[model samples]
Target: MVGQAQAVAAPRHHEQSHLRGLVEVAGASVLWGTGGLALQLIREHEPMSPITISAWRMATAAVVLLLALLALRRGPELVHLARTRPRQLLVVGVGTAAYQGFYFVSVTQVGVAVSTVVSLGLAPVLLTVVESVRQRRAPTPGRLAVLATALLGLVLVSVAGHASSTGPDPVLGVVLAVASGTTYALTALAGGSISRETSPLVLTSGMTLVGAAVLLPLLAVVDGPRVSADPVALAWLAYLGVLTMALAYVLLYSGLRVVAPSTAVTASLVEPVTAAVVAAVVLSESLGPAAVAGIVLVLLAVAGLGRPSAAAGPVLPDPGR
Candidate 1:
């Protein structure tokens, strides 16, 4: 009776952990989806380069997270991470900064859906290829099929009238979006490599600070400070920095504690979905039937990324920075 009772309790606890993981990952995704909308709001209020917004978003997040580290009495851990894993942290920070700059600039050029979908959708595929190379084996048939489908979806999105009349040049925009995806893949890989040793919160906080440090020169030299005093824009920037950067990442690392990495990736797919729906409804951006079809295909391909890994357990990494 005792043995049976213990077994039952173990499964029950596992189930609860899985449920909690779902909520955290989903919440993170939802919050992340809001970033593009927030940036749009800022662009509405003032005309500034997206790089400027990216710099400030990271800078503000770095300050908030640093203060948070001090408040939590984990300042020493942060220092330790910087000293020991400085190289890894550099990769994380640069990858973080690069992806955001590329994604945001692409967003302004291509509008939300094309930029968001293409950039987010390609990361998993690129990761898959790199993984296949590392393993010295061809990708499994399922993964190959999924990767092919995703590539097709990307092509369809490009051909299906991605450029808005007022949007940036489409050819250049798609190229940047691809670059953004590559950077995101690298960031995810860097995050996963260091995932075991550090507190997710501390690691994330450190990355933000490093990213800010790296980008500060560019922001100061080229962009200068364009922060607006309008309460409305300030409010949105606060949300992007606080909620999207700080809180979303915290929730991600928290969820990663209990959940499998693959599950987290699947849950976070809600971001592009949320972006597409919100953009269509709120921004009055019309996606043609082909684009809609392409979006669905991309979603399907992304779903393929969540399938259980043979031994490595799903490579879809990154606590979604």
Candidate 2:
């Protein structure tokens, strides 16, 4: 009886791994959610150019990733990947920069609430569309329904919310948010393929380096390449690079090891939730009824998106069994 009880209490390997994946991904989400607030705080305290922040974010993240790889004795592998997979690495890097750049600008424009909602909220759907196209099939009816619902929610939030008093121009903000989502979707596509070929750390590190290269000139042109030496500003940049960029990806890759791909993506929905909550509490940004409804609709669609469609046929018991 004791042995049976112990066996029953212990989770099977798959179940245990899945649970751990959930926890790891959830931790990543929380860290990512802190992103909006972090950026806002940086903007307030650091008051540097947007491009400068973007350049530093990617550059520092790349450096930190390199250091990590060196410590782990994978520096050679990282270099080999950069040399061999230059094009793929470039795509990931540019996409990373574009998404981050767009998101930060969107946050400035519309406050964390709307940017988080539109940018993060829209990525899954965009990814779904891209995947469906890549598979050379139209999205199933369920997917279409989810997309429609999510689109409606996006429109609702965009049209209904009042301009945040301290936020940037809503028109430009919404555009930037959508662009951010688009870039994120594209990045995931490229990053996913690259990640399959190499470890996540190396892929992220390479991409960040490439991203830094691509953003360097842009940063110079955007705000004349300014970086503050204030300890407080450095502190924020460090948190952004080390925690949000580097550590978050480490957790993400760790979670991906044990989680089903779709399930992992679904779990990432927590990021938007975290960002929204943090924005509300820390930034005093409030969503109106329509915006709240939009968020719910988008989340519902995301949940649906994560579920495998049963359009083909139901599973049947084996004849031999």
Candidate 3:
């Protein structure tokens, strides 16, 4: 009787853990979605260059993460990353920094909804290709079909969004958004390797610090003397540094402990959707029928990727984690 009782409790415990992880992952996605809204607010006031905003965001995130690491006495773990995974760490750092810098610039030029849709909608396809190449196997026909559909959807979204826009250079915006997606793909690939050896918190903190260091000189050279913006803008920036970038990773990493990596990645497709909804509600951005269809197609593509495949090999590790 006791054995059966214990067995019954075991499943409950596992279910509880899974539920907690799902909640954490959902929270992380929420934080990430808020980042898009925050960036939109930041762009409205004084025109701080995207490079400048990126530099400051990195610097601020590094400080917050570093302090948390120190408080936890995990400074040695971060130092060990430099010694053991120097090259990988550097690549991750640079890729992460470039992704942020370019993404901010792209969002500023193209508006958050279109920029996020293009960048994130295309990231899974890039990841699928990278995983196939890394494993020395070809992606299955189903995966390819999904990729083609997603790409077509992305094109539709971009065309629909651009047809009505008059604010910035559409060509330049597309280039920057694509660049952001490429760097984001690289960062995701790098994170897969790092998460195998290091704690996600340690790796994330170290990379944020390294990225901030790389961006510091550019901040000074490009933005000139930094001046304090309005209190509201600063508050949003603080929310971004603390909640979106730093705490979001913590939640994501914790969630990955219980959830399948593929599920976690697919769940985060919510971030872009959240951004779109927020943009529509807040900015009164109109989405035509084609754009709405594109969004659904992109979501379906992500859902297809979320399923584990024998041909796709092992799931890629969660970069946001």
Q: What C-alpha lDDT values do all the predictions have?
A: 0.71, 0.68, 0.69
- Which of the numbered candidates is closest to the native, going by highest lDDT? 1
How many residue pairs in model 1 have overlapping backbones? 0
After superposition, the stretches of candidate 2 with alpha carbons farther than 4 Å from their true spots are 1-27, 106-122, 140-178, 252-269, 283-321
Q: Tens digit of lDDT per residue, candidate 2, span 1-321?
A: 999976775435445555665567667877987865766677777677776876887778889999989999999888899888888888878887888889878877877657766886677666665556656887667656756775666555544543442474989998998999778767665665565567778887887788888877775567542777678778888888888888887677655555534344445666665666677777787877876886687567555543445111111111111
For each candidate in turn, the TM-score is 0.76, 0.72, 0.75
Tens digits of lDDT, candidate 3, 83-155: 9999988988888888777777777677755676667656766677666776698877776665666666665
**Where does model 1 exceed 4 Å of error?**
1-26, 106-118, 144-175, 223-225, 252-269, 284-321
Worst 10 residues of 3 by lDDT: 310-319
lDDT of 1 by residue, 191-273 (tens): 76676568878987998898888777676655534768877877887788888988887787666655544345445566755
What's the CA RMSD for each of the models?
Answer: 4.9, 6.7, 5.2
